[model samples]
Target chain A: MEIIELINVKREFKILNRREGIAGGIKDLFSRDYRYLSAVDDISLKIKKGEIVGYLGPNGAGKSTTIKMMTGILEPTSGKVLVNGKEPYRNRIENAQDIGVVFGQRSQLWWSLPLKESFKVLKEIYQVSDKDYKDMLDLYMSLIDIKNLWDKPVRQMSLGQRTLSDILAAFLHNPSVVYLDEPTIGLDVSMKSKIQEFIKGLNSQKATTIILTTHDMGDVDALCNRIVIIDKGKKLYDDNIENLHKMFGMYRIMKICFSKDVGELDYDSLKDKAAELEKELQENFSGDDMTVSVDEGWIDILMNEEDVSLMEVMNFIQSKQHIYNIKLEEISTEKVIKKIYEGGTIL
Target chain B: MKKRNVKFYLAIYFKIISQDIKSKLSYRVDFIISTMGILFTNIAGFITFWIIFKNFDNINDWNYYEILFLYGFSLMALTPTQCLFDNNWNLRDYVYSGDFIKYCFRPIDLYFYYISEIFDLKGIGEFMMGVGIIVYAWINLKYSVTILGILALIVMWIAASLVMAGIMNIAAATCFWMNNSGYVMVTVFKFTEYTKYPIDIFNKGFRIFFSFIIPIAFVTYYPSMVVLNSHNLPILTIIAPIFSVLFFYISYRIWMFGASRYNGTGT
Candidate 1:
């Protein structure tokens, strides 16, 4: 079942054009000049039930706007937005009952109250049954160690703890669809993994459909099976991680560390040596698509694995220098996304 | 959407208010000091009235005790909104900071949820002071009260509170379009001062402006006249309650319109 759908949805904001100087400010009072900026432009999507989808985008790419429309906090300017078969903006209260939202920069929890107090207020607001509330609490407690943080005031808790508590509060009512915007932002590795595990556990246990908007690729890797990428108010790519990798996964990075330090060479001499090495490698592998550069004491090679195998590059580098260590890395999702943003791949 | 009964909202209101009070009381000294500050400020106003009454025989045929009664009644009427709807004053900040989106994300009525987030404990001090002045004036005037009179007073008080709340909500809703509605709210709230005195003392223009345009005169001036039996127009007293309800209904509609136009700040 499709739990969320958007057909050619668009949103535009009227931005005031403020002139310079005091005299210009006075003129602004008399004249209303505005420029319309489209935030979400003619995007269509369908999200199925029990699926965790990563909504990824660059800055100002309309990711937040799309999430806002889905959560019922914003209305699309031109098209239809439906969550659970109801227009979210028109049936906001009903839609809100089944949807939960978490904004990393903005918190919905009561700052001065203890964590549990905020949860109790949410319990009353959502009208969660006592049995259901208790059962949810038990399930969460078993999955994570949050019992100690329950009595701490939200103001005193760290950012990660507060975000954790917020996620718990949002899911306390067992909302069928949850939207997490940058849930892992600014969190340390351990906290991030803990939250990822908790989200994974809840999603499996309840079969809740989750729409996660995040800049962190680790979050996408750990929690999402399908990913949607958007840029500049337009959808660029939408597919599973495996498909995305298969399309752009041929690139690889090979780092070869020299046994001798290259710091003895001057900056100009270092550039000269890197150029010489690049020319030599290109001459040797003429038809291969590759780029070579030299760091402090390491020679780095980025090449398409399909054109030139890792063994060929390693053998060539080994013959040129007394190698101390060699490291091979697959293309990271971050790099693939950066490449997509740079318009290197055709969608 | 499922239609929820009033009982559900009432239960949620009490829960939210109780939590608000609990958090407020955590800072015990701040609560005590602010409450005392409000009490002192109201007492200072009463003292100003006392000084004026000492010099004049009567202001517009109303004696000192009657004016005091009117002042107390105004304060009492203002207290309900003052206690509950204080969050309206921060609507500008909430909208600018994008915090208002949280209310829209909730399953409850936006206005009810917004107001329930805070319960001004300092208004308790204002309530006590108003009641104290009313009791003192009642004893001096030798006013014999009956059950019907008490019921009428309650109705008038509730109607007056609705007028104040309606005005405040309307003013605060302007923040959706403007950069800030703080100045607008303060200017409109200043009109309530005219209710503390006899509306007859004002010129025809001011009287009509307050009565018809803003309807602030109905908040306390005209309602108190009915209670004191000194009203020249009996019809004004009867329509005051109905007019207040109509004003509040219109204000609620305006609020809904403003809310629909709300485009939140950038993330």
Candidate 2:
């Protein structure tokens, strides 16, 4: 069931060391000086069939490079890369038949061709049987409803329409594995959700494995069951989404509503009181990250659930003030990713 | 290894061409102007040739009509190569923009997909002009036409086109390492202009260079020499087909090497 495997892969790119100015340009033409950049360094991963894996990383973190190697567009400089038990770059044409890829920034569709023409061309390239092609079209049309845009040239279509069409083309042949790099990038919220839904639909119907690379955390939350976080060409975290939440996703915001009205509480005195309460709470929950700020009638507290339980946090708050209401909010995945980038270790 | 079905590749090629033409024709004025511009350029080139040959009796024992035949043959060979595989000439852009990545994901042969994906229809005017000049030169020279002669001409034309394609492929492959090789293609294409005249007029070094190093002479000059019954080595001209096959294979190997490097390094 393991459809894709990358074993200790490393890819290095030679950077021509060029200086500025016309004279330098001339000298560079004759210069043999160059430096090598390791883009994907010593990474190993295995992706199983029908599993949606979120290949999450910041820019320049080697997400696309790994996808390229998996899709056979790139060969690792060292180690082994196998898709469906065949070395991808060594058997590219054979590997390509079972894989599909879409770069959100680049369209695989012909610029001047009608959407349908691109589909037909792909049909020939993959040798998709007519019945299967028709069935795919029917299924995709029902999911994304691109039938009306069939005759329109890809150039004239909006970004959402074009990306939708691209996704359809990628899955047209029922590829066993699909690599989607930022497929929802540059689309409106509604369009992004629609694409996410379509992708989910395809995976369920065909049991297709998907490796989605995206900056959108919502996409990762919605689609990916497992997440692989890479930073600077190294795998920092690889676990299911719930575990990521348990590890780095424990920050919570506590908003306390005081029984007293705004006029009754002196702003300066309340601010002083809130600062004193924060210092006391910090000592008790020593390793937990916490902060408190007071408004006219209420105090807002932010702390990590890993160090202090919700009951403990509320007990401290209730001892300080008579609360009329309380609001507890878990940290967003976006903030969790931000914290990961800031060097938060996996639990 | 399972080979791709030829019909499937042909279908992709025709589809790409049709789409390319549609894209070009969408801008009606631009397409017309570009086609007309090429036609005018060819006409002007012929006029310059007429002016030069008017005063000279012959250049290195070849008359004006014979030179016309040479130029016409070069055009016939060059146009098809440039037209069918025009996108290969834009490999610099493809590399810079990373559009080449799309070609890599396909099941088809990379070089085959690269060449077949774009059809420059502006070459139609160039082809028509070439045919007109060739017929005029043939009539004026009164070269006797036989079935074998016609067959030989067709084969020579095919070989010449292959030579041009091979050269273009090599130049495009350089972009894999160089990142920008438009100048390489332009320089090689300009060098082919030397084949439109008698090699004897050029210096001994130039002749040797064109004959062996770059082999532009084999494209039209040598083939024309055999066709005109002026071959110094008549038997050698028969090697054009063999030379073309070798050239194409070597160029393909070079392209594969470059592609592997590209994938390995991603530059």
DockQ of each: 0.46, 0.39
The 0-to-1 C-alpha lDDT of every candidate, in the order given, reads 0.85, 0.82
lDDT tens digits by residue: candidate 1, A138-159: 9998899997789988888999
Q: Compute the lDDT of residue A19 as modeled in candidate 1.
A: 91
Clash totals for all candidate models? 0, 0
> Candidate 2 regions off by >4 Å?
A11-38, A254-302, A305-328, A344-347, B5-7, B19-27, B230-236, B264-267
Question: What TM-score against the true fold does each predicted structure earn?
Answer: 0.88, 0.86
Q: In candidate 2, which residue pairs clash?
A: none
Candidate 2 chain A TM-score vs. reference chain A: 0.80
Candidate 2 lDDT by residue in tens digits, B1-267: 235777767767887887778778888998899999999988898899899999997988898889999899888888987699788777778777766777788888888876776778999888888878888998899988778777888888888888878887887788888855779888998988787887778999998898777888877877776567643656547788889889978988998788776642231
Chain A TM-score for each of the predictions: 0.86, 0.80
Give me the TM-scores of chain B across the candidates.
0.95, 0.91
Mind giving the per-residue lDDT tens digits that candidate 2 earns over A274-333? 899788888888644687877556777877777778798788768876788888777667
